[model samples]
Target: MRSNLLPILTALGLLSLSQAFAPDPEPRWWKGNTHTHTLWSDGNALPEYAVTWYKDRGYHFLALTDHNILQESETWFPVATAGGARLQPDQVKAVLESKNPLLEERTREGQREVRLNRHTELVQRFSEPGKFLLVPGEEVTSSWRSPGPEGRGHPVHINAIGLEAFIPPARGTSVVDVLNQVFDAIAAQEKSQGSSVFGHLNHPNFGWGVSWEDMARIRAGIFFEVFNGHTGTADAGNENHPGTDEMWDRANILRLTELKLPLLRGISTDDTHHYHGGKVAGPGRGWIVVRAKSLDLDSLTQAMRAGDFYSSSGVDLQDLKVTPTSYSLQAKVREGEALTIEFVGARKGDAPEPVVFSTSQGAEASYTFQGDELFVRARVTSNLPHPAPKVEGETQRAWTQPVLPGR
Candidate 1:
């Protein structure tokens, strides 16, 4: 009877087809961090404490991408008065304060051990519908050593976001080979899961490990970290190496013009390790704001792959609109803060270096497409100093995804 009434209402034009079924919710910007660690791996803090930190700071989602491990197994940590069990005093304090019932107190031969909560438990404790989310992920950490007297090696770390199972690091002869292997594995997982899973290359310049040319040669990965908050990585390259931004531009130029692969999108991540003190690799340093219908895993990952996100160290974008004919941006700024928006891109000719097409002052800027450009992207810089600057003399900055001429 209800089905017949719906058809009769449609026939009488009381309800249009568009109105008969609910449309998707309007997409909104959700703040999230893709790479962070806890005691599930080498990080100093407990899993619940990390979630509490981000949630309290208004982060919509957090991915705990521990090194080659998922938070699915049972684990325990020693309650240390001194620094023992690879646990610091502050870490123990944070864990005990949470009062998680899963924590088992046992006298293990001499030391007191407390069972740690698994990822499932963490999800049940913190995740709220459309408010905060915990995404399960893994850092497929791998390395390769060059065959020489010095035996120098490179760290190849790739992050797999929104995965249900663990994936071991894929190996190969060279850096490019290893990267391609990891991307292939990620693809296989996506195919098998029938869900959108996100993957990105992490910190290309950490060990001066991946060169711009190496990045351009990869067959698959479409995302990489343009800015990582960790101080260990050389984000600003020296005389011999190029920075991550340089690598991004050069690799995109090669990929779009010559290699015939898709342009790479940039991401900013905290890569957090320490949660206490003025530690270098701490949280709240970098993140991405994704525009999606809701703050769920599927929506966030879908929006990210669609290039509907912006990465930031400190600058927050007020508005970003990209159409087939133009690119525009406006930043949300505080008083006494100055803004500079650089419209950067390359031309359609042979091996053109990325040049600033135009620059705008104040809080807003834009550029109309000339139809002769390979791609265009924006960079917003502000005078406000980063609370925890990744590099010396660094200020606040944000990067938008590159826009192709059309499609």
Candidate 2:
């Protein structure tokens, strides 16, 4: 028996050694938020409250992207109104109670509120090995105060994800010039820090600030929020600019088929500003489910860079795969609810044209990219009731992972 045991143990040891040397398998479905706000800016919740809200809600990661500021110094004032909205007294006190002791001491002379977490502290509390993570981020809130009558200042908010420090608002004379400055700043950050930071144009249709032509011209970053969860951001139905969904399709078609740039993908984010029960930007409205090998920042960012994720409003897809033979999608519906999947794509000759396809009402569907199609993208809509509707009395939508041609 001892002799037999010796051989078995030896075999087990060899197997373990080989397994250690083998490459890791791909990961599936890491839930996270790439956009969020805290008390540092206009958010009503404390940094700790926001972190705990996501962590408790089973999110694998989060990015505390306050507007134009990193969680550095303590900030406070009388709970006054800005943009015609005031913080609820109870909400303000709740945040003030959670302030860090050191922060309280530093601002003790005339402080009304204290910081809950610095940028480093937030990251530390939420980030965990292969389980939970947090990345440092900031929303560069820039707007062009147009001089004409009906002189609505065009609001352009861009999120700088995975940044090491705060980037002050880079205002410009024009909207185009502002975006250029942003891209230039991101480029500089990349060169200096050796970090994997990416920028995305947020809420392009918010006040009709960014146009499709603008998106076509700026080729620096390959990401934008096609779906934002704030009020009046205009995710759908515009005269000149297409809906966010349509904008995504058009942008990809133009980039790949027309300009021959890399296929730019869309991200869905809860650009949450109101945290404590109000009718503004709230959580769980729209989110991205990334498929990566781990929850680490590098793995998550790499998967996003490779476009290995699907944006969702309310629908959930069981599986989304883009293969050599075909593009496939499988969705799970809410109990007793029906589901439909669509396979949309375009060909090389079909430049500047849209690809639209839909499946029969069922749980699964597939589309074959036969012959020379320039690209393929897909979307799924479910009969299940969405918690938040895009418009009144509208059904929910889930976008599939895009399948690029000849990749």
CA lDDT of 71 in candidate 2? Answer: 79
lDDT of 2 by residue, 1-407 (tens): 24455556557784454454457876889988888987778876667777777887988888889998887775553443344443444655564465342233133445344445787776665677877888888999988877778677888788988888677777787787787788668767866888678888898899898876667555677788878888678888566668877777677777776677777678888888777676678887888899998877778778998878888888778887777778878887778777777777565673456667545678788887776666677777777666666676656777865666546
Candidate 1, residues 234-273, lDDT tens digits: the string is: 8878899988987899999999888899889999999988
User: Model 2 Cα displacement at 378 (Å)?
Assistant: 1.0
Cα displacement (Å) at residue 25, model 1:
0.9
Candidate 2 residue pairs that clash: 347-374
**What number of clashing residue pairs does each candidate have, in the order they appear?**
0, 1
What's the TM-score of each model vs. the native? 0.93, 0.85
Model 1 CA lDDT for position 134? 89
Task: Please tell me which predicted candidate would have the highest lDDT against the true structure.
Answer: 1
